[model samples]
Target: MSETPFDPTVLLSDDLLERFRERAAVHDRENTFPDDDLADLKAAGYLAILVPTELGGAGLGLAEASLLQQRLAGAAPATALAVNMHLVWAGVAKVLADRGIDSLRFVQEGAVTGEVFAFGISEAGNDLVLFGSDTDAAPRPDGTYAFTGTKIFTSLAPVWTQLGLHGLDTTSDDAPQMVYAFVPRSDAVVTRDDWDTLGMRGTQSRTTELHGATAPADRVVRRLAPGPNPDPIVFGIFSVFELLLASVYTGIARRALDLAVATAQRRTSKRTGTSYSQDPDIRWRIADMALAYDALPPQIASLCRAVDEVVPPDGRWFSYMSGVKHRAVTMAKAVVDDAVLVAGGSSYFASAELGRLYRDVLAGLFHPSDPESAHSTVATAWLGPLDT
Candidate 1:
C-alpha cells in the first residue's frame, strides 16, 4: 500500500491487517510487543499522521486520526493501544500548534523523522490526573531539570526515544509548579520488564524508573500551576488522549458487532434448520449491538472536528470528551458480551477473538478520565462545583 493519498481505511489494507491479526495472539500469549506491526505502521507513515504537511507529514486533523485509530484497533487492539502513546504526543503537538503554541514543534518534527515519544505522566496513586505530579523535578544550574520518579504504564516503553512527562518542582521559588518536559532515553532511565497483564499485552506498557534523567532547558515545555488550570498543554493532552482512546474502543465495538453479524449468518440452528440470522432473538441482539455501536463514530468525529476548528475550549468539552470515552468503552464491552453469546460455546475458549476482546475492553476502565472521573466531570459541569 502506498503511504500517500492518506485514506484511513485504505492505509490499513487487508493484507496488513491480516498480518497484525495473525500475530496479535502470539504477542499476547508471549507478553511481548508487536515489533513487526510497529515497523509496518512506520513504513505506512502512520506516526506522522497528525504532523503538518509543511513539516513533511500527512497533516491530518484529530477527526481523521481518530477514525484511523478505530480502524487499526479493529485489527489489533494492542498495536493500536501501543501506537496511541506516540500519536498522543503528536496529536498534542498538533493541538498546540493549532492554538498558536509552537512549544511542541519538536514533537511534530521528531515524529516525521521517525522519533518515538512515549507518555510518562501517569504516576501511581496520583489521581490529580494532569493537575498534579508525584515525580520530583529538581532544577539544575544549567537550566535543565533532573526528573526523579517512577512512572507506571509507560507504553512503548521498550522502544521510545523521548518520554513526555511532568514533575513537581518543589524547590523552585514558585514551589509546587508542575514542570512538564520530554526526557530522552539514556543511562539515567530504566525500563522494568513487568508489563504482564490481563489483556492488551502487546502494548508492553512497562514501568519506567527515572533516576535524575534530565531534559535540557530547551525541552522543558511548560511550568504551570497545578489543579484544573486552563493551560493549552493540558487541554491538548486531554482532548487528544480522550478522543483517541475512545476511538480504539469504538473500533473494538465495530469489530465485535461485525463478528456477531457474521456468526449469525453462518451458524445454523439445529432446532429450526435455519441460520441464527433468521432467529428473532438473535436478530434483536444484533440490532441492539449495532444501535450502541453506531452512535460512537459520529460523536468522536464531531468532537475531533470541534478541536480541529478551534471551537473555543470550555468546560463542556471536558464533559463531552470524557463522556464519549466512557460510553465507547461501556458500549464496546456490551457489544463484545453480546457477540460472545451469539458465537456460542466456541467463543468461550481462550483462543476466540471475542474472548480476547472481552479482556482487552476491561483495560479501558483504568485509563484516564475513567467512569468515576468522567462522571464527576459531567456532574460538576451541570450541577456546578460542590461548595469549596
Candidate 2:
C-alpha cells in the first residue's frame, strides 16, 4: 500500500507553532473549550494525519506524529492532550486497516471534512485500567454491536464527531479478546458529566454513557489476537503516546526554565538592586532545570526511533517498548518537579505559566501507559527472556 501524503513542513513550522503558543496561554486559564486551537490544527490538515493515503489523509507515520505532538505541547498541553487522543485513534485504525476492514474511510472523511474525533476508554469502574469487564461489546444477530457501558475521563467528548471505543467482545466466548468499535456521536447518546479536575482542566475530559448503542459491523475494528499477551498494535501505539507525553512534559520544563530566566533577568530585588539572574543560587537552579529538560529529549527520541524501526520489521519488542515509555514518564515527572522548584512560590499562582505546565505534565502520566506498571514488566523481562 502507498503511504499517505503529508506536508513535511507542518511539523517544523515556526510560524504555526508561535500562533499555537499565543493561543495556549489564552486557553490555559479558562479551562473551557479549545475551539480555536483545534480549528487551527484542523485548518492545517493535521487532524487527518493518520488517515490512510487512499482515504484522503496525510498517512503520516509515528515519527511525524510524535514531532507534531511535541511541538503542539510546547504551546498548549491541554490542546496537545486532546489532539493526542485523535492521533492515537487514527493510529489504531491504521493498524487494523489491513485486517480486512475499511474503517479508514471514516477517518479519511473526518480528516478531509475537518471533523473532530475523541477517544473514550477510561471509566470510573475500570479506574483507568486497560482491560476490565466494564468495557465490553456484545454482537447481535443483525450484524450490529451493542455498546452498553459508562466511560469516564473521555477527552473531547463534548465536541467529538467520532469516537474510537475499546471494549471486550462479549459475543466471542472462546477467550474474550479486546475489541475496537467506531462510534458516531449522533448515533450514540453522549452525556458530558463534566471532568472538572485540578490539572489540564481545559481538556474537558468527561464521563460518557452508552446504553445499548448499536454500532455497525464495519465500524468495528478488532485485533486478530487480543489477549493479556503483548500486542504490537497496542504496544506500538502506546510507545507513541509515551514519547509524546514525555515531550510535552519536557516542553513544560523548558517553559518553566524560560520563565525563571526571564524573571531573574528582569526583576531585581528591591533591597539588593541586583538581578535574580546574577544570584548564584538562582543561576544554579536555572541550570538544573535546563539540564533536566535537555537530558530527556535524546533518550525519548532514541526510543521512539527504535519503536519506528522495530514495529515495521519484526513484531516483537514488547518489553523494550514498555520500558522506554515507562522511563520517559518517570523522567518527565522528575523534570517537571525540578521546573516547579526553579519557579518557586510563583509556580503556585494560577496565572503563571509554570502553574499550567506543572498541571499539564502530571496529567499525561496517568494515561494508559502507567509508568509504575511498565517498570514491573521491564524488570521481569530483564530478569529473564520469555520462556514460551
User: Total clashing residue pairs per candidate?
Assistant: 0, 0
Best by lDDT: 1
**Candidate that would win on TM-score:** 1
> Which stretches of model 2 miss by more than 4 angstroms?
1-19, 25-28, 52-55, 94-105, 125-128, 171-175, 223-226, 269-274, 310-316, 384-388
Q: For model 1, how does the per-residue alpha-carbon lDDT over 54-164 read when each residue is reduced to its tens digit?
A: 999998999899989998899899999999999999999998999889999999999999999999989899999799998999998898999999999999988999999
lDDT (Cα, tens digit) per residue for candidate 2, span 1-388:
9966545455547787777667766766666768877777887778888676777887676666766676677667788887877877676555546444454557657767777767776776464355453765887787667788888778876688777777777566554656666777754666766776777777788888887776678777553344454454465456555666666665565566666777778768777789877878878877876776676667766666665455453333555555555555555566667666655788788777777777777775677557666765676666754568
TM-scores of all predicted structures: 0.97, 0.84
What lDDT does candidate 2 reach at residue 261? Answer: 76
As a TM-score, model 1 comes out at: 0.97
What are the Cα lDDT values of the candidates?
Answer: 0.92, 0.67
Pairs clashing within candidate 1? none
